[model samples]
Target chain A: MNINWGFIVSSLPLYEKAAWLTLKLALWGISASLIIGLVCSVVLYYRIKVLERLVRAYIELSRNTPLLIQLFFLYYGFTKIGITMSENTCAIIGLAFLGGSYMAEAFRGGLESVSKAQIESGLSIGLSNMQMIRYVILPQAFSVSIPPLGANCIFLLKETSIVGAIAIPDLMQVTQDLIGIYYQTFEALFMLVVAYMILLLPVSVALTWLERKVRYAEFGN
Target chain B: MLNSGISVLVEGINLQRLLAGLFVTARIALISIVIGSVLGIMLGLIRTSKSKVVRFICRFYLEVFRIIPILVWMFIVYFGVTNMFNIHLSGELVALIIFSLWGAAEMSDIVRGAIESLPKHQIESGRALGLSFWGLYRYILIPQAIRRLLPGAINLSTRMVKTTSLVVMIGVIDVVKVGQQIIERSILKTPTASFWIYGLIFILYFIVCYPLAKLSKILETKWES
Candidate 1:
């Protein structure tokens, strides 16, 4: 029943490196998803009917299935058709695609929150569609989008762990790797839990602060 | 194109294996739902108690599970418990316990939300009518909470079905694990086996999840009205 605190202490440096890698993967993945989400949201917002069906299919497919299967499908399944990519590349792409679907839903909600009156005002002043969206719709949508987007970021952070299954060397991968080598299961797993807490605690706190700030602004604070 | 993948089927043995794998997944998810709902409802009730300490403990349990990945939680229980106590629980047992814990945390939130949204006058009126603590919840509160909880509970059920795929990471021979094995075995016979196998898994998942998701939505809108 004894936990090896000393072993965990000795392994702090390796855990730290893995933590950094996890953060990097989450950052790149979230950024890619946000871009994809924004574009998809824009297409849907404009009522682009033909593309909307394709986008909805992607979103529903990604949302319903397990992310692990998607990662495997891309990582292992692709090589069969003469497409090859590194583990890390495949992880990023998979994470981005998954995150993008959730982000698109958030963006759709945000875009809808931009009041119809504002768009009408832009039209009354002869503002072109692009100009109206740029000057009026986006600013408002950005505020409404912050909270859900932040939640999605946290979700994506936890999802980065799955990349380890594909041998991407992220935080969870490192923990599992350590477990395999050292056989210090409790120590490694405990360290893994603490490492995630360390990363998520501050990010969640900052998100709450950001949400409050945005809400305050909406209230003219 | 599709017929090529079906060519490997011999008296439906592969199909039977896939079905068995799916049965494992379903059994795990269903067991977790029942266990989790009971545990979650208890935790939810505890969270809404007047005692600050009780509420704090329940909230902590809920938040920790909410933030951590189920895969890590699975490892923590499966490996950490085995290592620390030298116990030899099977992977399926470990997965069941971990997923039930996860289900409890999620259900607690739903239960909490449903309870909080109810009118306060009911609780007060029950108190005024001299209902005891247990009587108040049993006679008045729980029935309403159960009604309000149905849509969310169903949604959680669907989510649990999807999330059970994580057990594959722990070497549990669930549907996705079986699919992986099938592809590996058949790879020599057909280079596209992985794709065909995974595509089937996706469809299976979609067939299972899509209807539940649709039901959840319908219930939600129905309840809202």
Candidate 2:
């Protein structure tokens, strides 16, 4: 069947709105994940025995469970527990929080790659642990971590599409509703494929470029 | 009301349904990983390929998966082409196809990365030893590559399983979809039933996935050791 470009074009504004929501969710989610992942990773990294085990367990729990299930837990389960938020907000928070646990390990791996010699070197220069992380380990680990961080961010962005399942009216969710209304599953899904491709492809390219820039900075090249 | 809701939810989960879901999920994952690994190996080989055309194709394939969300693949197969082609495909079949397509591209990149990361000395040494093409790959190459390859693949499998959640949107009756059905029914019967249904769904997924995550870490440490 020939495609209806007009019908797809007519959906552009809706797509734009959905795209904006997607980005908003990504921004909030990434921000939460970065903060949570960094703090949790550090705690997991340097905290003493029992605390370290607890952090490890938390990471495992977050990593192992399906994010969709987590969203359902938040959207459907916790509402009864009096921890309700709007579905959109729930999805964003769920994604960010789950994304954090993964990001934390990425941070941990990056930090861990900063060898003992470097840490001792930082200590010799009279920097405290926090200072060493901010000044020494992080800067040096930047190159090592940049690639994984970039990849993880892309993964996190893609994963955010799950919010659509929770009826957050994201790009995918909108497509579902459009399909329901239009009864043209093919056109609706084709538009969705293009929409996601347009939205996500550039974001991935930008992250790669960002990582490359970080690489050059790390090398002072 | 609580007791009956619990019974209904638990009724939805039994050897048949749980096993069916798990079986479908595991089958989709295994098939994707296996076939994808094959395609990826070919692509990965192409990365080191001397032919310009081969290298370009490999690069393009890697970029496709690297950028596009897995959902797009699902949509393209399940939503876009299936009806147009008049193919009688189940959602599970569509999911498998999409996952394999996605997996092949991912596995290729991992393979290429691992191969590239190997010590240049090892290859040169193999050549120096007058080893044949198979000799070098079988002996010097594959072993060294295994350690690096295992952890990434483990993580990817975890990813694949978690991603099966997307199948729910397409009517796969996955854990999340089941949870959704429970919630809807609960709303009609008892509003509070939604909470326990979702909570149980979460625990089910956790039971399935958490171990893989832990195993990945364990493998990472073992690799380091």
Candidate 3:
């Protein structure tokens, strides 16, 4: 099997640009999901009856369905109604929705992990409910949730590949394009796989380190 | 006008075609799960073996599969390998292999976790009682691990079912593919058809997966109780 190394070398710049787009899209999706998750967790924590059920249904639907279909529903279904957006915009929104559902669970677990005594102590200090959450609960919960949030981000990065199906010129899209031109399928795909590993491994390692630090700080060590 | 759009969309929908699509999706998922479980069990065992090379290889397999998107793998098998090997496999067959490989990676991790989580003393006791390695696995490790493994395995199956939707992208003509085809044909008839066709597809997937999700949860709670 002849693997063409020269083709991959020449295509480095294209892959690099695609990698940047992937990261940018992933960052946007991760930020939006984090914000949504935080809001939903806070709402769930407060036990607001009606909104709680609504959020639960949203989470279940997003979590259960294939994210690709979600992308299609938003991308194609919206066009049929004349509400057309760019593929990148639709992808970010679709990914954010998927990540948000999973992150809500992660945040909920973190929020639950914050001891009741911590909240009681905040109350004893004459803090209001809002202040108690802002000052005490959210900080603890944020640290507790970081690792899973990191995993969500990594998954979001992987999910960005799906947008290529809709013709978003992301990494996978560019890879497929190069494959069509060069017919160096193995070399192109191998390089793209390695490109992803390069992009993702650091995040995984950083998250693990941060998790360790959070656990240590939680113990006052 | 609203009623007209709904009527137009509903008139274009075909239940038999959609059901056929759903059957293909189910068939692929079941076969993928069975293939994954077998490969996963072997990988899981290798991961726990005394040989460093075997463990390293298993770890590499698990990590590589976990990090890469399933879509890329599907593309590699369908588009890339076929270009090089001069061997033609059906799209459905390629998808089956791709999902099985993906599922095996996930399942191995689940199995490894379940086995490692067991108490060390149980294995030690079994060894002390003169059981061979296979005997120890059969008598002690597996029985305990199977309980913990069941919930995760079922959950993986559900995930497999959902992800099999990606196969449609590679030309497997699963439910999502059929939905897209129906939508394309009917879009000229009524733009509303795109919405309803995809919506119906979404609900069909939900109908299939929700029960499996619940079953996994029920099994989890039952095992713990």
Candidate 4:
């Protein structure tokens, strides 16, 4: 098959717009997830009574299902109950619903890794519970959680591809549309792969660098 | 509203078709897992090979799969390759191949981690016993790694099962597609049908994946102790 270099060039602007939209969605989705995750992890860490069970169930349900079905349910299923949302709203909510649980797990791991001895030390020094969590627990947990948080960030970014199913016109949707309209399957897919690589590879590299820096800081101190 | 919703699900073998679609989904995941594990073990062993080129190649393969979403990969194979090569391949076959390749990439990482995490002394002792390289791995390395990797492998299987939902986009009659068709057929008569159908699909996926996840967790805690 002959390559269509010109078609690829012509589509660059369209892809650029779609990539921007994808990045925006990912940004909103990830930010929402971080808030949700932080609250849930704090509850779990403190072993808050009634909320813990609800949080656990939410995490399991979110983690087990696919983002596509979640989007479908949010966009299509909820209309019958008189809860309607725009496709963009549904996409962001779907992403956050899935991502929040993974983030909570990562945060939980970090929280658990802060040793009992450290908490005891804080208590013995007359640090109140809130102060203990703020000064003693959070700093160490944040450092430990950085790597997993970065991984979750990347995972959520890739998951934004499925938001196209709800017609948000992200990168994946644009590529599919191009393929359908132009019958330029090879060129369309080529652009899709390149766009993602451009989008993902730098974040992945930066995260690895950040992780290494954190590890060295831990060791150096 | 409720009666119409129930009828939409029960009408004209709809539930049976949904079940059949689910069967196809399970079949694809099961076959991919079995085949992918075999391939992944090999790739994982190669990843730990002493040769730099072999390891680099393995890493590249894993990264490519990791970076691209599976839906794009499905489209490339299901549409691009078939169109380019002018060969006819069914949607199910493409779904199987893509999922297996993805599964292998993921599983390889798990296997590599397990193998690498083993204590170094075991290999040194095996060498001292005059075991051949292959014999060393067969007798000492793989057996121990299996225990370490089982939970991770089980977790990957659950992920693959959940991901098979994407095959619906490629025109495979997976459970999600079945639900969509049912909703489309009954939308005017029973506008509430989508809620029930999609909810059922969600629950269906939950039923399939939740057990494996629980098993992985159980094994992880058990082994940690």
Where in model 2 is the C-alpha error above 4 Å?
A: A48-51, A127-134, A184-186, A216-221, B1-16, B182-192
Q: Tell me the docking grade of candidate 2.
A: medium
Model 4 chain A: lowest-lDDT 10 consecutive positions: A212-221
Top TM-score model: 4
TM-score of each: 0.90, 0.89, 0.91, 0.96
Interface C-alpha root-mean-square deviation, candidates in order: 1.6, 2.1, 1.5, 0.9
**DockQ result, candidate 3:** 0.66
RMSD (CA, Å), each prediction? 2.9, 2.9, 2.7, 1.7
The digit string of per-residue lDDT tens for model 2 on A1-221 reads 88878888888899889988988898888888888888887787778677678777777788877887788778876777677799878977898768888788788887777778877878988998789878887787777777777777777888877788777878888887877788677778877777778877787788778777776535322
For each candidate, what's the DockQ?
0.62, 0.65, 0.66, 0.82
Query: Could you give candidate 3's per-residue lDDT for residues A1-221 as a string of tens digits?
Result: 87777887899999999999989988999899988988888779879999999998888888889888888888877676677989989988998899998899899988988888888888898999889878888778878887888888888888888888777888888888888887778888887888898888998888888888877435222
> By summed lDDT, which 10 consecutive residues of candidate 1 chain B come out lowest?
B2-11
Candidate 1, pairs of clashing residues: none
Between candidates 1 and 3, name the one with more favorable TM-score.
3
Best-to-worst DockQ order: 4, 3, 2, 1
lDDT of 3 by residue, B6-31 (tens): 55434634667788899999999999
In model 2, the Cα lDDT at residue B55 comes to 77
DockQ preference between candidates 3 and 4, better one:
4
Q: After superposition, which runs of candidate 1 have C-alpha atoms over 4 Å from their true positions?
A: A1-6, A117-136, A219-221, B1-6, B9-12, B121-148
Question: lDDT winner among the candidates?
Answer: 4
